[model samples]
Target: MKIHMTRILTLMLAVFLVIPAFASAAPTTKGSAADLRSALGNLLGEHAILAINTMQKGYDGKADFADAAGALNANTDELSQAIASVYGDEAGKSFNTIWSSHIGYFVDYVKATGAKDNVAKQKAVDNLEIYRLAQAKFFATANPNLNEQELAEGLKMHINELLKAFNSYVAKDYASVYTTEREAYAHMLMTGDALADGIVKQFPTMFTGDIMNNPASDLRQTLGQILGEHASAAVFAMQKGIDGAPDFDQAAAVLTMNTNDLSNAIASIYGADAGKAFNPLWSSHIGYFVDYVKATATKDNTAKQKAVANLEKYRLAQAKFFATANPNLSEQQLADGLKMHINELLKAFDSYVAKDYKTAYTAEREAYAHMFMTGDALSEGIVKQFPAKFETTTPTVPTSPQVSTVTMQLGSKTIHVNNNKMMMDVAPFIKNGSTFIPVRFLAEGIGAKVKYDKTTNTTWIMAGDDKLAFWIGQDTMQLNGMNKKVGATVFVKDGRTEVPLRFITELLGWNVAWGKDKATIIMTKAMAPASAAAHNMATDMTNMSAGHMSH
Candidate 1:
């Protein structure tokens, strides 16, 4: 098992990057104690997410943490930076030390598990206990008149649950691991609730002074609901992964249920309609998975073929769902999003099938973790789109932005181009909306077979010798030979010809994605010759033999 550089880098990058913290303050002139509390609480929630995400990734066989773990660390760093921004350098240093230690304990657990040493494990656990005490102490000191005992108790429960989750993974009892992880998550909600309660109780006037009466403060309830639902979803995904259940419905149920949580969070920040739109679209994903699993189980090639045919149906419905949810989003943007979600699920399932324990873990980490980011993006987009209902209500801090555009990074240059361009530039073609270049391009680019169709003006892009053909035309596409319409109207924009950006890249057998309104076309060139003498390649980019994309 050779771990490709892309996957390794992806794993590493996923665990390290931090997301910007968004702690809503009163639309007032000065920073109040309530603002500080909100910031700190938000930071804590963010850290909790990161630490757990990282630990899960370690179990998955990627880096020491999941990609979300990186987001978590980034969150902690942001918190420290935020404190420094408002407080001072001293406060930042203090925050960093306390925060980093908790992350350290998680790393220690990883190190112990890697070494398979009990003494080291116990030492790590003991250190975490100490760290936990100090962690609570630090928070108490920051907000002195705070309930130190209650905070400590909450911290203890959090640490214990995390420890139990990790230890169960070490013990290879995945079911127990997921269960404990859920409880740990549930504990976080309780702690968050307690903290919110304390805030209301202390100031009396802060929470509209009717703190006692408003036990279900929208802020507290919203946070609790968001966090609790996320935890449950994470646990469910983990449980399914570990259970090795072949039932797609069960796995999809876990994903679908979580999507509901995500939808509610979005609704809280957006509105009812936006949330409602998310349901069928969200459910459709489960439907696709269910279809795929059923096809996979029958061991019938015909069934598998039919199941895959549903990919287009799934993609369109899913894409429409996003468009309906956020009308402002461009068709291209929505299409890219749909592909990303599709890729994540497929890659995740592939890892499971391959028994790539490490990759499986990474997929599990993603399944459990990425929703917050999704919720956040949808919420933010909606917040910008609509204002009144969510004026005072803060958006649940979202995870990192979803990979929005596809890019192609080969050697030194990270190129920006659509999937169609990449496919046609490297391969031969009909030169209409389907930019045809050369068959050798697929072979050179990512080892997919490129066959021509003189009779029908089609090009068949196949992964290996599989019957699957990525069929393309001027106006339509048949991925593995099923007619499917694309989001972007496939047309020749220039003489070179242009196809729907994502379609061509994916057809070329590359992992295509959208990030920050850009395209990311990642292709693992497994067999390209190292020496020029071994392979001759001199195709003019300006004018290939294939029909050109006449503007």
Candidate 2:
């Protein structure tokens, strides 16, 4: 039995540069996280298919190997372009050098496997191990969040799968070979996902908003998947249609399935009526692409013209649907974008028919990327129209108060008041042997009204039947016309009036307990006489001052 070089090469290439090719095809411009993921996923998935096909042909000594290699090269160029878009041309070139070396090693592995040379096989494996470590180290250094160990493990899994598939093919275990091939393809998708996520997180400004992975933007991701898959499947199906390939039906079915998912997504957001309206409008454009492909394949000039004409009409209808659905989206702009989408797909189909493989792949990438923009535009419109459904919100200031179970420390600036239901802006701090808290926060928390007489430099506190007034810089406070001494006078900090915590809490008939070990002052409603509470508070205050106070 003749050992097929193509079979081994197919699996090897399927697992090697396919992932980098997908990674490189990621949209360089700031897109939604969903868009980035979809781009990488689709590119990786497609490259896997091409890489596997290349190996199969190479093994069989068939002529199609050249086309397969061309497609893989096209994927690499797109990948490098994506990298150049993000990291600069020099970085992209550097990446190409390192990335190409691994592919060469995989080629060497396939060649050695064909010869059944044990020593050569071991050398290839050794080189791959070095490549894996180098690749992991490079990514780990580039992305702080991506651990070197984790990346090394992931790369090892990829290499092992390819090797397993190649070995199975050599042993004539066709089932195992195909099974491993599928696993290798799926693995590249996972790799693309990880790579896209890490890059997006590391450079959030390069993506739409800094929240691509945020659960709130799930709708965006879902839309990107549905629409992006449609673009990829539809384009590939069109190419198959032109070739009259046996898998054309299956490819076409995938396109239809993607359309159904998109319709369901729309129905979930709008009513079934809107989904019904959207389905045909969306499906019509796909039909026109098939028509264009068929016409091109048959050299039917008239049918080609008709398909183009129908697509123009489809564009207007789709644009109108979105404009009517979302007030924020302009119909004219949507039409223009849709037109570009149509042009890209047509160009790709035409190039494929013309056997201009490079242009076909490039156009395919552009068409695929355009769908992300479509998903983004549609999702943005839907989010705007039904903000509550998507659970989208304006970005909040990081320092703004968050509503949660409240907790506070004695010397910390963060105070949890109002029965731990809300956080207050004022932070409590120890000052001059006393813990000073924001008077406004304390008063509001305890249902008291605080009034400051700016001219007189006096602050007044009004509770149900209690009235207390204090003068700034004065040690004496008036409690219903009786003078009482306070440890510290009222002062302003951070635009909030600060008062001694113990004096204010005790005066309002609230009990204060000092936790010396925890450095916490727990306050609750007093159950004893105000005088008893004041005595306990005074003792605790002295202890707190002696043990924990700082000027």
Candidate 3:
């Protein structure tokens, strides 16, 4: 599938990458964890997509099904080889055999659906159940980390999801088809990640870092997944539109899902207003691309040129949006990358229109892969812009009082205080560029006394020697009787009075850290700075030394 840039998809990558802030406790390493997991995801996701297209074509008795099936088989081989490369040639061959069985069963089901043979379909389903057991066993035998029953259950879900999409397609429920198709594709990515995790554990020396907790690496992987899906969705939608295919509306609707996901992603990182503003600009290029497709289909050169010109405007607009949002991002690099994304998408579509299927497919792959580069470049810029957000320092710093970390998800009712978990009526939320958590959490979790005075519309908190007072909708808060302006005003949300997290915590000589991963707040309690703690220790030692001398 060609890239839409996938227009907003580039933005989508930027949006999704900002999520998963607590991917791992380990530092982001491209070598073992990120690269391997992403590589597997790429191949597995591609396989699921190709299989869907191929099966659909086969059901329709389309000639291109052969080539599409070949692509799917190639992916299967690559996956086997990846396993073999880690284990041995025999292992690879065994994986191929077990994997091939599942694909064969799916093909049988497709053929049965085409022939209107319910019995054949049931037989195919039965065969898939057997294939699931074998596939699960193969993986379980390969690694102790992978549970057989769990693998079997996951495989069943995979089988059922694909069948559901195919059945929906057969029934002409295009919306459900695309929706389930997306779920199936995502499921494959999870499968790839699971395999990577087991392999990484099996050979710890071969991999450098953990996969689940590295926020930066998760950013890279998630960006690639979202952007790659965008490319495929755009390609499918554009093709349907150009062909006047019955599923065009459904395909386009799925594309809209991508747009919303991207917009929400942007909102999660940038802000609600930024995401709202970003959606229209980000979606404009897509409409422009549709114009290009419409023009191309009608052989209207002038209209096509106009569409291309508009895309150029979109490219600049997209670059500017990111640049304006983040000065750390390089406009030149973004524009160049977006230009390549646009060109490859256009090239793929043009090739498909000319009946040059090979060229079209090749260009589609390029467009999909290019988004990974975009993700990498954008993630680097964002990481540079917000280093504190990604920093996860363990082994708390030395202070007179031990530092205790509190981890809170943006909208979750649960909060993690050091090793303990507590649930609150209200969750943390971002307001005016700061996170706000419930005041009661400070008292219950961190051994602080907090009170809300309904008459005065004020709240007070005392953590050790630190005392802080703030008023609702107020910009200034009194810290130890001295008022200080904060990034956000204290306010009431969801029937709870919320204070600016950093302003209140950091004021008490504590540290506040949150994530690009959906605004996860990690506040550390530090009663005294290390310098003050050291000075106190030295003074006490000197007094003791003087007393010894006097004695």
Report the number of the highest-TM-score candidate: 3
lDDT of each: 0.45, 0.60, 0.68
Ranking by lDDT: 3, 2, 1
- CA RMSD (A), model 2: 22.8
Q: TM-score of each candidate?
A: 0.44, 0.52, 0.68
Backbone clash numbers for all candidates listed: 34, 6, 7
TM-score head-to-head 1 vs 3, winner: 3
Taking all chains together, the TM-score of candidate 1 against the true structure is: 0.44
lDDT string for model 3 (386-439, tens) is 655444333344524566677888789988877788888898775433457787
Which tens-of-lDDT digit does each residue in 503-543 have in candidate 2?
56534424344444536656654222332333333332222
Report the lDDT of model 2 for residue 33: 55
Instruction: Give the CA lDDT, 0 to 100, for residue 137 in model 1.
Output: 74
Predicted structure with the largest lDDT when compared to the true one: 3
Candidate 2's TM-score reads 0.52
Clashes of 2: 6
